[model samples]
Target: MTTKTEKVEASTKIRPRIGRWEVDDHNEVALLGTRCAACGEVAFPEHQICVNCGSESTEVVRIKGPATLRNYTIVHQLPPGYERPWVVGYGEFDGQLSVLAPIVAASRDELHEGLSLSLCVGVTKVDDDGEEMYSYQFTPTKA
Candidate 1:
């Protein structure tokens, strides 16, 4: 947990994280989530308190993919951590879940809603000190 120098405790065992929620892209391989017992609403980044019903009681879960694309954007501009000219946007799945992720669409013409995709773990980039930064990306089922 130190800056300027990077060390990954265990690369093979490490998973994605949003705040304290650990996202394991294995069994339930999409985005890890939580559902509210009170309202049956879903949340990403796994919230303990449901925003929909304000319920403290919740079930931590993961969304398996075979997801249908909701909507997409071809990014001619890339963010600080992204490669230039990458496509990125929301990938909507069943159960009302949507993930804001990079879409590995073959071409801009091929991007659209309802395209089938799956979750993949990959090295996004190498940082200043040569640490391999990893993340989840949704790619077309065949690609």
Candidate 2:
């Protein structure tokens, strides 16, 4: 039998499901993206080559938030391994960067176009190894 401390330790071992994101001690999430040196375009998940200019020159940059919700969909038909419904949306930041991420909301009525969202990290699922997998998600910013 596992002790209580062991369970806590295991729960704290979170692994990011995607690359280019970091979580602080407070659980605040910061997404890392790449900026094209040639075209000055920014992209998430950090690309090696610039998609806009076709240039290999790129630099890693942090994505600053307060993303404005553009659109969203509530998915009821889940894929294999998913247990419940979830919302996903596109949020535009800085009037240039648009990121598609899962949205965390208490109710469907709380979501709408132009809602301000902030980046956060949470456990999306557990892996076969019993490790918690975390992904970047957007939550409604507290007014």
Candidate 3:
């Protein structure tokens, strides 16, 4: 019989596409950021030094809540190795942290400025080693 830990490990074989995010045992995705201890400023992707006060006192923090879509655009021309077009947008969380990521939607008409977005993890690409890679993206929250 398989153990619980083994089952979880086997099910979570997909690796993160980047170092800025992580997937938990429940498959929940959270973006890592840095919060300045001195100035209370938050920066995405985490930072070693605070951009506001130039202090090295910073701690890693998880970004939460639905982000507000500030702006977006559809890209028709993609770089080599990419087959389909995609939508990218700038979203702000808590009115403080802003992140630029791919927007997953059924159609371009579904997207609009000031729309609420939730963070989620999805398969992005397969590495040369044939392993699936996952990345964080923003999806429109259900009405």
Local distance difference test scores for all models: 0.66, 0.77, 0.74
> Could you arrange the candidates by TM-score from highest to lowest?
2, 3, 1
> Clashing residue pairs in candidate 2, if any?
none
Against the true structure, what is each candidate's TM-score? Answer: 0.73, 0.80, 0.76
Candidate 2 lDDT over residue span 1-143, tens digit each: 21122344455555443555766666566788889999999988788899788899999987867899999998888755444788889989978788988898647888999999998766665677765655778999988
lDDT of 1 by residue, 1-143 (tens): 12111234444545445312233534234556888999998887688999788999999876667777887777676546666677766777785777777776457766777788776655565565566776667788775
Residues 11-92, candidate 3: write the lDDT tens digits: 6556433437666666556788889999999988778999779899999988875899999988778754332687888989
Q: What is the lDDT of residue 40 in candidate 1?
A: 90
Runs of candidate 2 exceeding 4 Å displacement: 1-17, 25-27, 128-130
Candidate number of the best TM-score = 2
Q: Candidate 2's error at 18, in angstroms?
A: 3.3
lDDT of 2 at 88: 87
